[model samples]
Target chain A: MSEFQNPKARKRGLVIQEMPGEMLVYDTETNKAHCLNDSAAFVWASCDGVNTISDIVREFEANSKGTVTEDFVWLAIDQLSSKGLLEAKVEPKFKGKSRRDVLKTIGLVSVAALPIIASLAAPQSALAATSCNCSSNSDCALQAGMCTTQMCDNRGMTPSFTCVA
Target chain B: MTSLQYGQNFISFGVAIRFESTNARLLQKAVKTANKALIGNLKPTQKPPEHTFVFGRNKELGTFVEHNGSIVAENEIERGVFKYFDSYLRVRIGEYCPDRVFVHSGAVGINGKALLIPGNSFSGKSTLVLELVKLGAEYFSDEFAILDKHGRVHPYARPINMRTTDGKYRPYTVDVSDKADLKKRKPLPVGAVLFTSYKANAPFRPKRLSPAEGIMTIAPYTLPILVNPAYSIQVLHEVMNGALIVKSKRTHAPRFGEKLLQYLAKVM
Candidate 1:
């Protein structure tokens, strides 16, 4: 496993929304929404296949208007990887180092918090349930009105539902 | 082609629900109820509906809604009806709303600005909004705060859907005289976003949340934020800009409502 592979980061069908100092990414694949801090956003944006770990660090420092080590960039990468936001999974580089140790190594530069990505499971739209093709009940489990039984009607056309319990 | 006869009824926020039922009376009642909820004091929409929900009910299956043509809900009529309505509003409002963002929160206009209490269904949004309404704040909505593109809150005042003593989702019209009597108040800029939930014996403790925190906290309860994330994010950023976002936990709703007004007065 290329643990040190420069992360070829591309949001997995995610749409990024920028706030005053943070970013909210809607992961279309997982239906989860993630909040990226300024540093995390910078690191994520810089994680193009072309940029190496050092490039991320430099970008973070420049964008955050502060100093952070390779650990800061790694921390963001770790989070993005864990959230499945990255197109290809990259192993965490902090093999022997802990978060506290990395923080201490980087020292307390200037920032509200370390680059962090916080997320929550988002609620789906109501019509998301019957809006798909299904053959069994479990297919509608994640939908707003979960299906108890699924039936494929009209052969190739979109499956219509009788009811949901 | 099972001869499932159905008709469409337009609802609030430019959504339409199509119902299929053998019981003509039940279907008519449901459509009437939905229309009453939609056109409260406002003119009926002439625009065609954008989405259609096909629901059916019978003796053996009791009541059920079909998604695509498959059964999604069954056995409970009230549950099925409300589920259909909730799903339709949640989906279509966000889908067609190019101008507003929907928050699953209770909103009230206090001193010319909107005070929004954001939470999930069981998070005491309706109860808290009702309490605020009794305290002389004009009710915007108990279920949603439809925030326009300019960050102002509009009234989506469907009769405050509340759990009756018998544990049914009945319309609570304590503040509004009739279910169809909706107030056509001008949209107000959001003064504060209160992220609160009721707790037993927990004192009202409030902590200020940053705009990002506020958006993140309310994202789950917001419609279209997940489906149309890009537009949702843009709308939310505008909707939450310059608004005070406070996370509070309280046991007493009336006391919390009073304190909320006091807090808004100071902040706004």
Candidate 2:
């Protein structure tokens, strides 16, 4: 089980929440909601402290079977920026998750790990781990933003849960 | 440059109208009454007075004008409007500002959220709108509404501009009892362009329209449909971006206005 922690990357002006099948982005200026599809969702999910734009591109490229490119990632970022989504944060690259490291490691990762990471990066699963399920859903006897279903040992991962019924 | 003062508040404008001819003189009472509205409560923002001159202009404003062998009063029809230069519109509480700049026959001091209705005659444009006032909709303006460059349509709560049985609009005449500026014209961007069709018995029908089609439908509502293609495109682009355009119709005027109001309640 892997932990999905997004570093300070989303942007200053938006509120991003993970839903069941889609990721919802709320733009405060227009008071509107914009959603991301599977591909866009992949890029948005990879906007974590451990990933760079190159990492996002590589992951998306693998998902699309190498049909996308770096230029497409840049263009997508531009489109998101225009839609008031991805804002310029001026964040320096993390010591371990640098661009070159991403290019090299991403080149080595097995295509087998793509779907696994995608499932782990499930927008709803990420949200289930973060939000206060105990407060909103009375049945949620669990803490917020963590997999509410079951508790694990030192795995640091949320285990699958089942309903009482 | 005479300034209009309402009660104790004085709002000045760069453009001023002076009654110089018999037709204009006829509208003096209406202008003065309209000025009372300007002075009473409708506050438009005011700008510092500026001065400029147009090269070819004739006759002062608010008077009957003789053009091309036909007598058209400024109150009757908008003519030579191309001659205006450096005009500005402002809407604030007590400052003398233009209610709308793109207007042909405008009066300052009027106030309200301008509800624009632009459509060809017999489109039930005036009938449904007048009925709206009867059904508790505030009267913004009659025909034309004023729009800014950014396409913000001002809301001027003037009297309803309905064609009376005698064929004229109803102006607010309580305080002054003057001859009304019955047929003044302005090219207002429709706040809700109901591209309507009058029916004989069907219930009022209101539908949402794409912004593009609304613009195309609203252009003709502006006074003076000249031969200029650019004119249609210009007005069309602005109205499309700035306001909510819909397709509304009713069997009769009463149900039409009520349903139109009901639809606006959902959107606005």
Top model by DockQ, which number? 1
Q: What is the C-alpha lDDT profile of model 1 across B1-268, one tens digit per residue?
A: 4435645445455444355566676566556545554544222444554444455666777665554466544554455455445445354555555557877778998888888887755467788888888888888888778887777888877666554444433334454534343444789988889887777777766898777777777777777675567777777777677788888787877787788777778887
Candidate closest to the true structure, highest lDDT: 1
Report the poorest 10 consecutive residues by lDDT, candidate 1 chain A. Answer: A148-157
Residue B6: error of model 1 in Å?
6.0
Q: How does candidate 2 fare on TM-score?
A: 0.35
User: What value does the lDDT take at residue B209 in candidate 2?
Assistant: 52
Best by TM-score: 1
Candidates' lDDT values, in order?
Answer: 0.66, 0.39
lDDT of 1 at A126: 31
Off by over 4 Å in 2: A1-165, B1-64, B67-115, B120-124, B156-158, B161-191, B224-236
Task: Give the range where candidate 1 chain B is weakest over 10 consecutive residues by summed lDDT.
Answer: B37-46
For each predicted model, how many residue pairs clash, with residues at least 3 apart or on different chains?
20, 19
